[model samples]
Target: MTRKRQGQQGWGPEHPEQHYLVQPRTVAGGGDVRHVSEYLRASGWRDRSKRGGPLLVESPDRTLRVAYDPHGQPGGWTIHGKATGSTQEWSAHLGRQTPVEIVAGITDTLPLPRSAHAPNVWGPLADGGWHARFEGNSYSATSPDGTAWLQYRQEANGTALWWTGATDTRGNSWTGAFTPTTPLHVVQAFSAQLASPEPVMRPRGRVPHSSKIRTWSVSVTPSQLGAWQQARINAARAATWARNSRRTDRPSTSAPPYANAGSVRTRR
Candidate 1:
């Protein structure tokens, strides 16, 4: 008897045709084979692959939905929003002007959480909304996902100053007075100083071995910060028309402007 070769298929070798079977599936589309309960269990492949394309998919519930600019990416989940609370209290440091240090965990002591961000020293327009001074850094409460509300931090000298926004119940003054139209799921905020450093600070004698201890002089007045706060309030208001504009857009067309000398606060 002659030995059969590995690649050759003949009567003597295991019949290959017998191994192949013809079966039909109920589902017409060519997708992964999964139970109705497990809709996309075996379903593989992304629909469109482009910068902004749509995605083709079947939900776990077996519902089919068309997504724009298909990326064949995984389905996104929903996130719940959270409120910063109804109270508004803040502390102001008079040294220069900067974001008040939100004493960690003691946020409740102020008005909202000490965790809230301070407003920008730069003035807002007659109206208010998000302000993206630089490329895309915005001073607005509300995340890309629309699940969070962010605020700005005010700084003076080289440190944080009074934390504004979130107002008191009596419409007096408190820590956090601002409330989000939608609850904040993610808390996002930041602080910064004048790029030139001339507006907010003054040059002190250079240190023997370190950078000069720059001082902050308010470019805008407390009344200005207050006005900016009001603008913010109007912007946050749901019925306000100013909310239509972007927040980063400053009222003054002047380029790279800073706040006037106000007050300063130091880090504790």
Candidate 2:
């Protein structure tokens, strides 16, 4: 007898690829360029420019591609990818939102785990406060309040069972299990368990009083004050002169004339 992999029992390789196409509520413009650029960069898309055409953004692996037109048809960015299902997944992730909303969405959906990790199966959660890490069939997450772990087990019948466990700051422990149909409930319970009360900090020692201290008073004549001001100016000029002289005396490290003969020097 042979054993089937945990997640591969019911899953098939020819599953329909997920595709998403998000049309902005408004046309792409200068106002949202930064946001779009950031999303593309974070998603591992690089700009591929060509002669006499719009700019193309492609994934490093060449599995995904995107193009944007601020003034052309569609009036927004168009995303496409191979049958890996990432194209639709990214499109759905982008969702139906205005430019600003999409930017916020991108900001929230970050620090995605590697493809081999369980997070790739669980996906990003609604809660953004916790930091998550994965190892093999188990994953752990920690927030300001507490920490939690989720582990997967393969039953004899090829049914996958997930065990959700957590411990709060108050020394309370909770554990539960769920099938694939109700996995979100496990996540919700885990998130609730992680919502421990915030800690309060109190000062430990009495602050020192400001009154009990020795004092000394000195007065400078007008001439002395004038001399001090003149000294400061002279020191500043001397420092500036030293810096300029050091720069002037430094040896030239420029390349030979042939290397940069065609380069133009612009006025400072």
Best by lDDT: 2
- Position 162, candidate 1: lDDT: 21
- RMSD (Å) per prediction: 28.4, 28.7
Candidate 1: lDDT of 138?
A: 29
Find the candidate with the highest TM-score and give its number. Answer: 2
Q: What TM-score would you give candidate 1 relative to the actual structure?
A: 0.18
Using all chains and alpha carbons, the TM-scores for the candidates as numbered come to 0.18, 0.26
Q: List the residue pairs that clash in candidate 2.
A: 18-88, 19-88, 20-88
**166-208 in candidate 1: lDDT tens per residue?**
2212221112222232122112221111111122212122111
